[model samples]
Target: MIRILFTMIAIGALTSAQAQTIESGSHSTTGYIKSDGTIENSSHSTVGYIKNDGTIENRSHSTIGYIKSNGTIENSSHSTVGYVKSDGTVENSSHSTIGYIKNDGTVENSSHSTIGYARGVKKEWAAVVYFFFKF
Candidate 1:
């Protein structure tokens, strides 16, 4: 009986850990743009932040890049990496069409690959929200 209980507990723990990993990897949620320019997930977790100067920072508060007023996303070295167009489309710095934010908040990569999605608002609203909060 003791061995059985131990085995079950171990299994449960393993399963829980795996679930957390999966959740953290491709988690989708409605993020909010705080008054201070910090972005928080649906669960109120601080994923990153955007500074007034357009610097993007991760949860650890490390500067990653910047988002230009024109919607261009640049690296820390100020090189343009990607951009979000006014039409809700995302593209690489090379100007090649990458992907688009659909009417349902789905985000796809250049290959039409689903990186993740947004929740809570209409397509346009979601796009606008993401445009400011994107990291």
Candidate 2:
């Protein structure tokens, strides 16, 4: 079951930029993931960024973490923090399932409860920003 779940995450290279809305489970607008990788609050204030190279940065441009090409997530110190698997299974450093990013962009907790949504956004980005709160 774990293997099957891990296989479901859609890992891939960063594609062309397209702005996407981020919403809470209740469907309230939370923020926006912009074409240029800027993360903004509903008020349109810059909050963070997700670079094309998978580098996560704060509003101040400090390195926060990384979502690697092969689905490995690393902290600024370059330590393995967690992973957003190819199948959308989000696991901690210990490799235990914590959440999931569904194909339709629905974010779910380990119990499979809907926690948020990131429609039209890349699963890895959605997982990091919405699920992991990396930025």
**Which candidate should be chosen as best, given TM-score against the real structure?**
2
CA error at residue 39 for candidate 1, angstroms: 3.4
Task: List residue ranges in candidate 2 displaced over 4 A.
Answer: 1-18
Clashing pairs in 1: none
- lDDT (tens digit, per residue) of candidate 2 on 1-135: 887666554332234444688999999998889887889888888999989999999999999888899888888888988888888899988999989998999999999999899887888788778656644
Clashing pairs in 2: 8-87, 9-86, 9-87, 9-88, 10-86
Q: After superposing candidate 1 on the true structure, give the runs of residues whose Cα lies further than 4 Å from its correct spot.
A: 1-36, 40-44, 111-114, 120-135
Q: In model 1, how large is the Cα lDDT of residue 100? A: 70
Model 1: how far residue 11 lies from native, Å:
43
lDDT of 1 by residue, 38-70 (tens): 666667677776677777788899887777788
Question: Which lDDT values do the candidates have, in the order given?
Answer: 0.60, 0.84
> Cα-based RMSD of the predictions, in order?
11.7, 12.0
